[model samples]
Target: MEIKNEYLRDLYRRVEKRDPNEPEFLQAVGEVLQSLAPVADRRPDLIDWGVFERIVEPERMITFRVSWVDDQGKVQVNRGYRVQYNSAIGPYKGGLRLHPSVNASIIKFLGFEQTFKNSLTGLPMGGAKGGSDFDPKGKSDMEIMRFCQSFMTELYRHIGEDTDVPAGDIGVGAREIGYLFGQYKRIRNTFTGVLTGKGLTYGGSLARTEATGYGLLYFLREMLQKMKHEPVAGKTAVISGSGNVAIYACEKSQQLGMKVVAMSDSAGYVYDEKGIDLAVVKQIKEVERGRIKAYAERVPGAVYTEGCKGIWTIPCDVALPCATQNELDLAGAEALVAHGVMAVCEGANMPTTPDAAEFFQKNGVLFAPGKASNAGGVSVSGLEMSQNSMRYSWTFEEVDRKLEEIMKGIFHAAYTAAEEYGCSGDLIAGANIAGFLKVAESMKAQGIAY
Candidate 1:
């Protein structure tokens, strides 16, 4: 990525040299820095204040070893990490992903992206990400419980409601959250909002499970109205992933009169000619914890295909890559462009690669980056934090309405920022600039750390 501003170019080069092996982190840095050239040119004092340089580096990175005993009395070990990227506006807020793929680079990438995503929500939440390489799949409840206890044993020392709050991601969900929260409570001896995505019986807020998916649609609806004066009604949509984000995204899109034709899991994708049956999907995924192929078996007129990436090859008016980062590559973007995709809004962090995102923008696809489009989860997490502070919880309708309003506010913030920066309709740039400026201003106000 070429940054036009001389200062930003130098900073990018320095980051590249410092972390050459971290492709994901470098990719995120490149995207944000490239979009920031315009801001850098206008506010050269940012360079003088070392905001760009400092923001790229995490405030703290903690790595630890997690060891636990399995059901067979076998010892299992995994690595855990938390990258507290930034806390200028507020305490660190992000998700904890547990999977075999967890590593320093991936956590850094996620943490870096979370900084801007939290910022775009217009809430006083900073950014951080923590996770372990412990795979929770196929583990017995007691095994998972023991692992969560061991992981939290070291992690509890670094987190708090006001300092840093970690929620679920990837392999981490409500079940895992229950175990982790139980252990945290046992060790800390007090209940606080140290974690989001808790059970409703506890400090958890309503609408959190549906926040990201519903938030994505809310942002997309706003984008559609602004660009085409339309809604998602009667349109065909393709979404990747069968997790919480994809499942609820299907529900919300269906409720809005859109036909979601396909959804996927890691192993494969299931395509239905008619709109997907949300009830059946919920039963298979949420209830049975089965793979997506089971959806094809249970529902008629649906075909199961190997390889989840093939989901993108199916044509649609809209595409939501709710899966992992870089899932939608340049080829996928080209296919979507070829299929006349009107818009693409990400429901996952950095789901679209840089090349693909630029292709969509150049071809006038009304693209929205994850930072702006997927801030709803964190927005409501912030709401959960607020509720935790007040010892009160809002109703589902109330939280959902607040999330919709915040998504609209984020869209306008990014959109207006893009227009101001002379990059109208380029939400990728708009979001980066909007989020960067807020953090930059805060960093400036705080003065140099050292």
Candidate 2:
């Protein structure tokens, strides 16, 4: 599993010298470089055509000021950004994350991951991600509306149905998408499908919210079956990030007979020895918009820890890191392995760092990287694009079924690729190799764009 990507190494050096502060960007490059190991070992055309270098850097990364007035009449300025990573296959498509951690590095990592995640879904969508540093929590609807409107005012000119289509991520949800899409419509005066995660009344697709989480479980199920691992029945699992991905992953895992004992947010984590109460979690996160600490009050015997770390140390057979990027570092991963975690699936993109990923692989743990495991969200996003293009929407069951199938197919692709590359059990390598091959072939076929 040696990576011969000399070009990737060179690009990494240049970018490292330029942006030393952007760990997310470096992590994204590292994951891609890990994937390109097999490709670089096998392909000279890719090296000669500069495919390794060009794809490492985004096609365009736009930053702007999102200036809006709060309810207190104070002018609040937050930075907004969009990274169009690649589009050799189709229009740019990814989610918009509005966490306070929003920056060029985070967005670039998400967008870079999106490139292959979308490609792995067998969809014709490229990768892009945008977000603002504006925190939606504790903000009134009016203030949030003004912020979305301002963000979209400039972003509208760069995106459309035929161009880049964005969806909701960490801090952005149906509410944010509704506001952003409303502004787009008001400005463009066209009822086109410019965004995927819109409200149902405004042409949004069903099952989109459950796509990523459920898709993660589906992929994990396939992995378990292929590897002849134990069924999820009676398994204890820990999930971080009580957002859409964590909640849905909790739901599907519960249905599949896994007990999710822990879930977390940026502020902290909640652990219920009897498995998380999905209803309570949804109420706190989805409706009340409260922190993870609130779950302790409603659920008996549940305790809330004031940090995202060590939530992984609670001893679980399955560990799903649905939190933000690199939330599961080497220490956390070592803890999970020490606790005898048999399976680790990423429900969040790049949630595990390279060192952690290598630790899991080296320790013989079944690892599903974000590119392969958490791709359900963008795969459903691609489904939304299809429904929009055809002027129709599918039923929830239909969409869910398609999502499960897609996730399973992606799992098989990685599984098969791993076997072919002689890294049969190294799914991290398999996924990176599989996803990179898809974009690489497309990049080569498209030839030099300049």
Candidate 3:
């Protein structure tokens, strides 16, 4: 979309000129600015306050060196980063990702998107993200622990329960969180809710593991019911990635009577005519840490494809991209549209590319942006924060109920905001506008420095 608003155009140009090399961050900023053009026409005060300018830049960007020893007694080094993007509404809250692809651009993009995701949850939390490029795939437990300890040695001083809280993402899971938390505790000599996604024995909340995946279906259900008056049951769905998000999303889709016929991972995808066997997938991904292709070998009459992107070619009524950023491109969107897919809801952060998302919208497919659909993980993180502060925990049913309500509220907020802003049925605009307005108002109320 072209930026017709002069104020937004100029602000975007400044961002482009300042961060010429950060394409991911530039893309995120451009997408949000495009959606806010309508708001800029009505709210001139935001331009005067320089909210857009400040919002695009991180409040604090920290980089440090993490050095650890391997089992071979060899010294290894890695880079760590924490981008405290915005805290206008509350303290910085986001996840700590660990992947070889981690960098300044990706971290900034995730952090920028997170500000809105946290806001859409109607929770008192800001947006921040931290991670390292350390690959935990083949590392032994002790090796991973050493890396986490080294990473936390520098990170502990900058985080706190009331200041900034970090959780797990991508490569950072329960084991990684435990190691990082242990280091933080040993260094600070105090236990607090500085981290979420902790073990059940610690500060983690019930239903936290399944929050993002389950929350996604809730949002999709509301969108389907409200927009088309269609029920989710009996619908065929395809989900990508066999990680935590995809696994639980499949589980919820099956529970809702939707047939999840296909699922994928980095290696490949498996298509089962009889619908996916969740137990087998869990055994392969969670228990054995095996490849997705193994699902085909175990399940009768299942076909396995070599490439992950080919999973989109399969026909389905609903398509959920639960994979990483930009996993679904224009071609995938076109294929889904040609197959008569009704809705596409994101389960990962920015899983759909700009053109693909636009294509889905143009083709009458209900599209839900990641900032809205994937906010479930952070929503539960916020709940975990509350539980930790209260020194109490909610039952799984209680937490799941709250999660369902939060997801529905997010859907309605986006739906209503889009309609109000003359972009009815365009959830991208609605979600961006609703989430941005809340943060922008809070920023304006707190003054320019905030």
Candidate 4:
């Protein structure tokens, strides 16, 4: 372990050269480097891609050649990845994503972000991310099953109930989890809780489906209740991405008496003047498994647009970007401010760009960064781990209550850390600094690993 600032620069250079234009990767790495600088100074020996950087990268980023037989028996070979990024805090825990955008850089970036996010939750879960380049939208069920089996064949060796637990992400859901879990059981010769997001008949948590969305609103409630600032009820809200996170955000917000004006997918967004109908939207998304275009058809008088960027243009007091990384840009931030947006809580990881985040802070918006807001999903996953170990089940209300308390505590921790660091009103810095401090302190106390 050598503490050389130049080594970090070299690591950044290598990543940048490989990615070239991945702003998200660069931004995430930059934040990590910033957080680790103090640690590097204190333990200069742990520098230069030492245990820290290597752990920051991945213990093993297994990219295997997955060839599966489709329904027609035509063999399809897709690149699959599982970034066992960091296991210092606990076993590797993250999600499996499947989309055209899946790649090593993206997976690594997400895994890196998850390390701190998991740590901040006070959960004994490390961070990892796995996914494939296969899109499940057009794939037949048989084809998806084959692909999942193929994926689990390689993923089984590196994961276990006490080792690593992967969950659902953008493209992987109930069906995919079932397939993967089945494969894991067949390969491991045991029925264990090696994965979260399992079917209810299995070891999955009850409220895991609605965890992220509900947890986000719970965090927002705490953020709003600070100093009795503002209530989400009666507030106009906009959410991006018509997937699980977006749909659930709408459901919870409506329950809290908010006017959700719009929700969107990659194709576009649907905006209704008189608050979005949660049941219809959920049917269109969670049930029908369709795009937001169908949303306008189901709900009369609602308009759907093709480009998702314009989603932020609609006026709202609150905006929840549950879509993807960097979905809300600087212009979107300005638009939200212009429309009198009071708060922006992220239900997705790194949904706001650095510039957009800075713009919101400069304009006085209550911005709960993704790390604090979207932690509900993983926090509950940790709870599921407990239930699995104890061989007991908790009521949905009980799990939801624990989620609410954790979200509130995370929000408060970040807020108080900001206050202590004299970084008032700047949540991005507060969150990044606070989240990293806990992990960094733990890493240092553990001493260097050979």
Please give, for residues 1-450, the per-residue lDDT of candidate 2 as tens digits: 234666666667787787799988887787678666767777888888888878888999999999999999999999999998899889999989887878888899888888988888998999999998999888999999999999999899899998899999888889889999999999999988899888888788899989899999999899888885668788899998988999999999999998999999989898899878899999998888888899998888999888789798899988999988788899999999999988899998888878898899889889998889999988888999899899999999999999999999999898888889877887877887888888888998988866
Q: Please write out the lDDT profile of model 1 over residues 203-322, one tens digit for every residue.
A: 899999999999999999999999878878988999999899999899899888999999999999999988899899899989989999999998989999999778888989999999
Give the local distance difference test score of model 2. Answer: 0.88
Question: Which regions in candidate 1 have their CA more than 4 angstroms from the true location?
Answer: none
| Candidate 2: stretches off by over 4 Å | 1-7
**Looking at candidate 2, what is the lDDT of residue 186?**
97
Residue 164 miss distance in model 1 (angstroms) = 0.7
Going through the candidates in order, what is the number of backbone clashes in each? 0, 0, 0, 0
Residue 35's C-alpha lDDT in candidate 4?
Answer: 38
Clashing residue pairs in candidate 4 are none
User: How would you encode candidate 3's per-residue C-alpha lDDT over 1-450 as one tens digit per residue?
Assistant: 577788899999999999999988999999999999999998999988988888999999999999999999999999999999899999999999999999999999999999999999999999999999999999999999999999999999899999999999999999999999999999999999999999999888999999999999999999999999999999999999999999999999999999999999998999998999999999999999999999999999999999888899999999999989999999999999999999999999999999999999989999999999989999999999999999999999999999999999999999999999889999999999999999999999988642
lDDT of 3: 0.95
- Candidate 4 — worst ten consecutive residues by lDDT sum? 1-10
In model 3, the worst 10-residue window by lDDT is: 441-450
Indicate the residue-level lDDT of 142 in model 2. 98
For candidate 1, what is the TM-score?
A: 0.99
Global lDDT scores for all candidate models: 0.93, 0.88, 0.95, 0.83
Order the numbered candidates by TM-score, best leading: 3, 1, 2, 4
Clashing pairs in 1: none
